[model samples]
Target: MRLSELSVGDHGVISDITGLPPEQRKRLVALGLLPNTPVQLIRRAPLGDPIQIRLRGGDLAIQKRIANCVEVCLK
Candidate 1:
């Protein structure tokens, strides 16, 4: 499922990042978001716009639209 569809506390491994913009895809990759990498839904904003995720020893915040581009296999 799309990363955006995962609820807080869910864990998964990234599967596809081809749906993101070229620049964004590169940036995410640099931060260890490559395919098969493990990820966890940390939290969400009060309005649920941006979602927080933990991966590769750190956390990153992703917007709703961008999150839709991240495909993951839930664990």
Candidate 2:
């Protein structure tokens, strides 16, 4: 499933990131959104455009479009 589809409090390991521009992909990786990393959906904006997530000991808010490119395997 895509990260964007995860429900709040869901936990998963990142499987892949695809369908994104190279720069965006690298930025996400730099922010610790890498394959095999554990992540949880923390919350979402009122309109759901930006979603908050917990990963690598920190929380990040990313656009739904970017989250849609991130694949995850639920734990």
Q: What is the C-alpha RMSD of each candidate to the true structure, in Å?
A: 1.0, 0.4
Q: After superposition, how far is residue 64 of candidate 1 from its true place, in Å?
A: 1.3
How many residue pairs collide in each prediction?
A: 0, 0
TM-score per candidate = 0.92, 0.98
lDDT of 2 at 30: 90
For candidate 1, give the lDDT. 0.90
Q: Which residue pairs show collisions in model 1? A: none
Scored by CA lDDT, what does every candidate get? Answer: 0.90, 0.97
What TM-score would you give candidate 1 relative to the actual structure? 0.92
Model 2's alpha-carbon lDDT is 0.97
